[model samples]
Target: MTYLGEIHSRLLDHRPIIQGETRYFVKEFEEKRGLREVRVLENLKNVIQETNEQILPKCTETMQDYLSQTLQRLQAASHLVYKLQQKEQEQRKLNNQHLLISEKQRITQWEDFMTEQHNKQAAVDEEHRKATERLKEQYAEMEKDLAKFSSF
Candidate 1:
């Protein structure tokens, strides 16, 4: 699936081969050095075992340190991701509030404009009624004046 996975699979598949090679090399070394001499063979075995024991603790410590560092880095990354998500949510809330405020302002402006238009219409109607009443009074006076002249 990935390069690391392939490498891990290959290592696992070759484990027996690696073990066989190690055994063969150790046997060859013993043969070349004349293992018939028991003391010499025993001494070499003891030396190899002791060296391996000494290095094992250091290797274990190094692996532990690497794992600890990796865990810390993962934790920090998780915290940062959480903070970013929180910030995004807050931003969305603020944007929604702004949109609501803008909508309310638009509605108020429309209402004010409607009220002003209604006031103007009412004023025009009142002026027309007053003009009509004045015209009626003038016509009545003119009729009375014609009647008097006709009688003379």
Candidate 2:
């Protein structure tokens, strides 16, 4: 869903270095509750670039090159992690929206069912009222006839 494929690959390239860095830092510093706070790889990306252009040309040290490569990897991993987090947030929001829509639809269906039942009851009541009125009329007629015939 994201256009961070290239970035993700770049991040993968530095995985080993970042892992080692994390392990080293976490092991080196034990006082902190979390290992991530001991950022042994601080600004490696910046250092790598500066060293490649200035220090690498002058010294040609393998350690410097290695450090640079590791930094580049870390930077990519960091970018990918940020993008993934955003994607997760977006997914959560979308799920919530879907839930809201479903709830509204359910409520509408219930309301429609209630209205239909109410209409049916009203129709039935009307029919019963008419039938009762007709019966009352018939009863009145019978009573009148009996009175005339019986002289009561």
Candidate 3:
């Protein structure tokens, strides 16, 4: 766009040089030739001016509008991507928390199972000790009965 503007400016600046050369040629020729040459130069000037002032500016404005709309769409897409990333991060955090809670529950259940097993073992040991004590008492009573029978 800037290059187009630069070329337009250069054309405007060089208009006088073209007119000077045309005038020099008209002076070298006769009156009819000078008149025809001047009219042709005027027509060419009009066309160039219309193209520079009207057509170029309209085209430039259209290009600018297109670029602006494209930039807006790109920004919208970027915003959506950012929102999705945030949602994904939030989901990951929730999943991790759920896993931590589940692990804690599992660990608690295992501890309870171990404690119950220890309690059962302690009961079995106590019963075995009591049975041993009862057997020793029976043996002493049998020895005393045998001695009394022999004396009689």
**By lDDT, who's the top model here?**
3
Identify the leading candidate in terms of TM-score. Answer: 3
Candidates, ranked, TM-score: 3, 2, 1
| Model 2 Cα lDDT, one tens digit per residue, 16-77 | 78999999887777656444543545567678889989987878677788899999999999
lDDT of 3: 0.90
lDDT of 3 by residue, 11-104 (tens): 7778778899998877777666877888899999999999999999999999999999999999999999999999999999999999999999
What tens digits encode model 1's per-residue C-alpha lDDT throughout 4-92? 89988777778778899999988887787555668777988998898789877788889999999999999999999999999999999
Error of 1 at 122 (Å): 5.0
Question: For candidate 2, what is the lDDT?
Answer: 0.87
Q: Weakest 10 consecutive residues, lDDT, candidate 1?
A: 32-41
Local distance difference test scores for all models? 0.88, 0.87, 0.90
Q: Give the per-residue Cα lDDT of candidate 2 at 95.
A: 96
Error of 3 at 62 (Å): 3.2
1 versus 2: better TM-score goes to: 2
Q: Assess every candidate by TM-score.
A: 0.42, 0.43, 0.44
